[model samples]
Target: MASNRRAFLAATAVAALAAAPASAAPADPLETTARPRPTTARAALAELLAGNRRYATGGSRHPDEGLLHRHALAAGQHPFAVVIGCIDSRVPPELVFDQGLGDLICIRTAGQVLDEAVLASIQYGVQELHVPLVLVLGHERCGAVAATLDHLRTGAPVPGHLELLVDEIAPAALRTRHLPGDWAEHTMRANTVWVRDAIRADSAFAAATVTAARFDLDTGLISVLP
Candidate 1:
């Protein structure tokens, strides 16, 4: 009987937490009075960068994650941008960029490595969903980048399909191996730039503007690479 009561109390507490309001600002962009959807590439980039600023500065509004917003997204979704990032737990694009449901179309991989299916999904988002910005996010101290570098030094084969990732990233790792700064950082940035440029060259996404950026795990900031 005591255990039953404890479970009941826990359930009630969860319900109460869900019922609480997230913020005063209205959530849905589809609503007439709410903010309009981003239509241009530059505007989408600005919104994403601003969201990152909010996250890094401890001012994240946590927009569009409420119950009503979830309900609003059930009928349809029109996200403004697409983020291709690593599969690292700390670098979730939605949380790091401070966006909520329906704000971004995110695709995560072990090293942001590309396959035909990945390219197809991105093309579909730009052509069908009308998302204008495609940001490829690499990060500092990436294990994937490190692993690729290790393979370059040791020449040992990786296990399973992990070898595919090493193969894809090897070119960038090789290209930047002799550069001045940290080889890992150079490879990470170079890999991001290569992915962005590859997408631009292979895709005819007129509305989509591809960019490369690196996430700093320590500072929680994302810097665009030149």
Candidate 2:
């Protein structure tokens, strides 16, 4: 079943990519007011990594996301990057990465699963907001991952509607079952890598932006995949 879903996802991505405008084709949408400029993808990625490093080392320079910041962003926003992270309260992208309002376009889902809503949010980030980078942030000891691991090992279906999230993550969890160290932690990292690849392989956004980085919660460090 997992394999079938993966194939379905891959095919969907291909179709979306085929429909997207070619990268080389010239046609910039007309913009009113001053054009909203975004940082280069690499630069924006670096900033996020640096902030996460600070968070890990107890040296975080927290962003001021106060009332003034909110008001300034109400009329318009030009976030530099998009972060599709888990719904885990501990993994809030703004606080963990020390970013202010209008700094990041964030989308959260349980297990960081990609559904239509999440994909649309990502599309809006790249095509409309001109965000240069997108980060699929996943953390250690994720409850969703833990649940999936249980489902894989014990053959016990995740209870109730939670099965949907576990089902999405079970493939990645099963792949890492033989790896060294704690299985839960291993599964967590594997889940992060899997989600990262899912975004990179997406048809529409892959060509528009580089999909190449993951942040590990345990180390509070960013790992760039070649």
Candidate 3:
């Protein structure tokens, strides 16, 4: 009985020693791969969707603004894309896309309307920073779209510079006026397409960056309407 007890203790010790290396060894290289490299359009789009899933599923990898990372990024930034979107509080581009700092260049307009200044900003992103993609994200039941529609359909006088915004967004609303049901919703989507086309039309960079950018809205997916 004494001999058997001693052997059991020795076996247990050996087992623990054997398990130590397994625990101490670093993870598999493939299992712990570095951040993905997105050079191509498909690769870029896939990454955006993957991040969006994390956003929608509440597993967001929030912006990493730690001291080390911030110091590293102080020199310059290489934002992956630019998002031209509405100014709605809930529709923040970073939160919706689950992107971290230095990930995106964002521009906000009341109705995502494009004019000279807006075009210049976009041109800088394209001509200078060489951002790989541009997303025009509009949302469901957008207040700006609703306001524009009201102004066009009823000739209501919207206050201040809002009148100019309405004028810019009026064409889409007018085009969809004769549609049967859900005209506002349809026009909202149309407005998104309009902005996308306006960007493409306004800049030579648009043609140069063809098949690299996309436009979509908050429909649970990043639809690429290039």
Candidate 2 on 94-184: residue-level lDDT in tens? 8788776678888999888878899899999988888889887777778888888777768876678897898788888788888888887
Q: Quick one: best lDDT, which candidate?
A: 1
**Of 2 and 3, the candidate ranking higher by lDDT:** 2
List ranges where model 2 is wrong by over 4 Å: 1-38, 64-68, 210-219
In candidate 2, residue 169 scores what lDDT?
86
Error of 2 at 181 (Å): 2.3
Q: In model 1, which runs have C-alpha deviations exceeding 4 angstroms?
A: 1-33
Compose the digit string of candidate 3's lDDT tens values, residues 88-204. 887787887777667778899977888788778877877788776767877777788888887877887899988888888788888988988887777777888888776767654
Score candidate 1 by lDDT: 0.89
* Cα error of candidate 1 at position 178, Å: 0.9
Task: Please identify model 3 stretches exceeding 4 Å from their true place.
Answer: 1-34, 207-222
Candidate 2 at residue 93, lDDT?
87
Which candidate would rank higher by lDDT, 1 or 2?
Answer: 1
Task: Please list the C-alpha lDDT of all candidates, in the order they appear.
Answer: 0.89, 0.76, 0.71
Error of 2 at 12 (Å): 73
RMSD of each: 6.8, 21.3, 7.3
